[model samples]
Target: MVGKTHFIGLMSGTSLDGVDAALVSFDTAGPLTGELVHTAYLPYPEPLREQLLAIHLPGHDELHRAALLANELSRLYSRAISELLARSAMSAETIEAIGCHGQTVRHRPDAGYTIQLANPSLLAELTGISVIADFRSRDIAAGGQGAPLVPAFHAAALRHPTQHRVIVNIGGISNLTDLPPSGKIIGFDCGPGNLLMDAWCQHHTGQLIDQAGAWGAAGTQLPDLFNQLVAHAFFSAPPPKSAGREEFNLGWLDSHLTGTESAQDVQATLRGLTTYGITHAIETHCPNAHEVYICGGGARNTALMDSLRAALPGKLLASTEMLGVDPDWLEAHAFAWLARQTRLGLPGNLTEVTGARHPCVLGAIYPA
Candidate 1:
C-alpha cells in the first residue's frame, strides 16, 4: 500500500487581501481523503494591495510592474510556507510539493488567456521545494473557462453517496459546485460575492471589508440598485462560464450608479446582490440539492449567511467546517490537493465544471 504524502497549498485569491497557506496530507493508495494539518496567513500591506488592485486594469509600464510584483508575491508565498512548516515542525524536504495559485490579475477565457502572477521558480528557490503554479491556462487552452477549479477537489472531498450536495465558495466572486448522487458534477461562477461590496465599502468608508456585513445589514436594500446590479448579462449567462475583476469591478459598479444613493443603502443592496446571486443559482441549477455548504470569506458575513438562510428555505445551510474543513481554509487546502494531483500526473480539473474539451492535468512544476 502507498503511504500518505504531504503538500503545501498557497492561495492569494481575487480579493487581493492576503495570502493563505495550508499543509495537507493525503492517502495516495485509495479513494481521496485529505487531512488538514497546518495553515498560515499574511495580509497584504496596503501599498502592495493597492498595486495589485491597480494592475488589474491597463496601466503604463504594466509588464515591468507585473513582473516585479510577481517576484514580490513569490517572496510573500515563501514566507507563508516557512510559517506553515515552522508551525507544523516539518522541513521543506518532508513535503512533496507546493501548490501556489498565484495572484490572478486577469481571467478572460473567452479571449483565450488567464494570467496569474507568480514567480514559481523564485518560490521553489526560496523554499527549497517543488512548486506547482499556473493551474488555469491549460484548461483555457482546451476551450474552457479555467475557473471555479475547486469543483474537482470538492467532489473528491465533499461529495456524498446518497445526498444531493452543493458547495458554494463565496470568495471575491462566488461560484457553485453541484454534487448529485448519480449524475455528472456541475459547477460554475455564479456572480458577485465580496468583490463589489468590499470595493464599495472601501471607497465610501476606507474599510477593507464589512465586518460580518454589519454595515449593510444596518441599512436597507435599494430595489432599483439591486435590480440594476443583477441585470448584468454575466449573471444570467449559461454555465461553463467564469468571472473576475475584469467582469465585475468598481468601474462596472460606478457605471451603474446615479451617484445619489446613500453609501450604506448601496452597501445593503450589494449584499443583497451577492445573496441573490448565490441563492438564485442554487434554485435554478441545483434544485435537488438540499444540503448546501459554504466556504471562503463571504461565509463569515453574518448578514449574508442570514440572508441566504432566509432565501433558501428548507435547505440545510452551513459552512464546510461541518465536513471537517474550515470555511476559510478550504480553498488553500484545495491547492495542496491540486499540487498532489499534478505531482502524481493526475487530472486536477473537471471538464464538466470548466467546460474544457477534456480533463487535463493542470499547472507547471518548478523543481526545488
Candidate 2:
C-alpha cells in the first residue's frame, strides 16, 4: 500500500434506491489496480426518494425544491462518508478526495444540458474532505454524451489482455463497455435496466423491486408487448447515447401498455426488454466479445440473469466479481478512481468511450 492513494466514491443511480459509498485505494504505479477496502449502501428515505423522483417533471417552485433536495443529498452523502470512514477505521485526512456522482434529475444531452443535483461545496463543508464532483458537464461541454463514464475505469481495472470482453452495468439504465483484445474501447447506454420494471413492480406488488425477478418469473412473456416496448427509438439510435427518467419512466411504459394484460406479465415483458436491449447492444457492437460481466443492482436479478445467459449463448456470462470487483460497488469504485485521476490532473473520460473530442480531465474540485 506504499504507492497507493485512498479515495472514496459516492454514487446514487437512476434507481433512486440509495447512495453507494466505496472506500478504495489505487496503486500509484502501474496497471491502475485498486482494492475495494470498504463499501456501504445507504438507502434514501421514502419521502426523499419520492421527492427526488417527483422533480423530473414540472413542479411548483422547482428551483427552491431542487436546492433543498441538493442540500438533503449532501447531508446524506456526508453521513455515508462518515460511516465509510468509521467502517474502514480511517479518517478524512487520510483520504485524497471524495468522488461524488450526484443524483441526476435531468439528462437531455441533445438539448445541450444535464443536471446532477448535489452541492459539492456543502458536501466539502460538511465532511471536511476535498470533493471532486460534476464529472459529466465537462464531457457534455466537449460535445460528448457525458454518460457511461465507467467504461474508462472498466478498461483500466477489468480489461483482459487476450480475451475480448464486455462489462454491462445494469443500473436504472443499462450501459455496456466493450473491450476488444486490440482496438479502441467502445461504450454507450443501451436503454432501461430496472427503472421500468422497478416502477411496475412497485405499482403492483408494493415492493421496491421484483426481488431477484421472482415476480417476473411467475408471469408469461407477451411477445407483442415485448416488441412494442423494444420499439422505443432510443434502442435503434447509434452509440454516444444516454437516457434517464425522462425517457424510460412509468409514463413511457404506460404509453405502451394496453391495460388488458396482467401486471406480472408486464413485469416479465419489462425484464425481457432489459435483457434484449443489453444483449442486442453487445452483439451488434461487440460480436467477438466472449466474456461478459454484469454489475449494479440488475446483476442480482436472477430472472434477468437467466434471460441474459439465454440471449448470449456460447459466451461466459457472470458478475464482475469474477474479475475482483464487487458488482454492486464497481461504479462507486470507478468514481473513486476518477477522483484519483482528477486529483493527479489526469484524464477521466475516454474520448473513444464518450465520443469526446479528446481525453480530458473531468470534474470540479471543492476544497475542504
Candidate 3:
C-alpha cells in the first residue's frame, strides 16, 4: 500500500507559546505507524497568545469573540502548515491530511467536558486538506479524562519489553506514562512543568526559558517551599486524572510567594517543584522503573534533568534522542499518528490507561 506522503500535525499546548508544526511521513497510512520527517514551531504572535490565555476562562461576551479567534488560530495553523510544506519543498497535494490537537481552553473531563479552541471546518477550508480536530471530547464523553492523549503514541514510539520504561512529558503540566512490560499503559498529569517556571523566568529575568537552569541555579531551593508546592493532591491522585494551567497557574504561585521571595529563589523553587513533582509521581506509580524516556520542552533543561536524575537515584534518565527520536517532536508526531487513527477509524485512547468507559474512535475531522 502506498503510504501517506505527508500529514501536518498541529499542537498549541497550555504554555500558550506557539503552534508546533510537524510534517510527518507515514508508511502505515493507518493510525499508528507514522514517522516524522520535518518539524518546527511557529510561535504565536503576542496578540494571539494574550487572546488565548484570556479566553480559556472567558466572560460570556468573550464566547462570540472566542469563535472568531478560533478561526484566527486556524489561519495560523494553516500558514504554519503552508510554511512547513514550503520549507520541505512539499506541496499541499502531497499531504494526505492534517491532525490538529487544537488549543485547549478548558478541560474538565471529570465533569464530562474538555473544550479545545479550534475551527476545524475553517481550518480544512483554509488548508485544503482533511483536518482532524477536537481529539479529546469523545474520550471525555466516555467517562475518561480526555487528556494527555499522547501516551498511546508513547506506547508505540517507546515501550521496551526487557525494561520497565516511563515516558515523562514536561509540558505546561507534567505527565508520566508507565509502559511496564507486565502491565497496561498508565498516565496522568503529575504537576507543574515549564508553565510556571517559564512565567517566573519571564517575570524576573528577560528569558523565555531558563537556559541551562542558569537563573534557577542562582538561589537556594527552599526545601519547605518545595514541600508546599508538591503537596497538592494532584500528585497523589490516581490515573485518568488530567490538569493544566487552571490548577497550577500564576494564582497558585502567588499564594506561595512571599514579598521577600527572591526572583532567583523562586526560579530555583519552581524548577524543584517540577523535578520533585515528576519524581514523586514516578516513585508513587513506578518505583521499579529501570529506565525513563524524557520528552517535551522540559527535557531540554539541564538543571531539571539533573534534578530528575538525583531524585530518582537508581534509574537511568535520558531523552527520547537517546532512542533516536527528538524529544521536541514527540507530541507533534503523536497528533500526526492520531490524525492517521481518525482517518482509519481507530481508537486513539487506551481505555485501561485513561480510564475511559470504553474505547472510542477519537477526533472530528474536517475535509479540505
lDDT of 2 by residue, 1-368 (tens): 35868999999999999999999887767457478899988999999999999999988999999999999999999999999999989989998899999999999888877899999999999999999999998998898889979999988888878999999999999999999888889999999999999989989988998999999999999999888888889998888888888888888888877899998888898999999899989888899899999999999999999999999999999998888778999999999999988988899998887888988899999999
lDDT for every model? Answer: 0.92, 0.91, 0.84
**Tens-place lDDT digits, model 1, residues 148-221:** 89999999888999999999999999999999987899999998899999998998889999999998888899
TM-score per candidate, chains pooled: 0.98, 0.98, 0.96
In candidate 2, where is summed lDDT lowest over 10 consecutive residues?
Answer: 26-35
The total number of steric clashes, by the backbone 3 Å criterion, in model 1 comes to: 0
TM-score of 1: 0.98
* Local accuracy of candidate 3 as per-residue lDDT tens digits, 2-63: 65557788888887889999988877545455777887778888888877878866477887
After superposing candidate 2 on the true structure, give the runs of residues whose Cα lies further than 4 Å from its correct spot: 29-31
Runs of candidate 3 with Cα error greater than 4 angstroms are: 1-5, 28-32
Residue 355 accuracy (lDDT) in model 2: 81
Q: Which stretches of candidate 1 lie over 4 Å from their true place?
A: 29-31
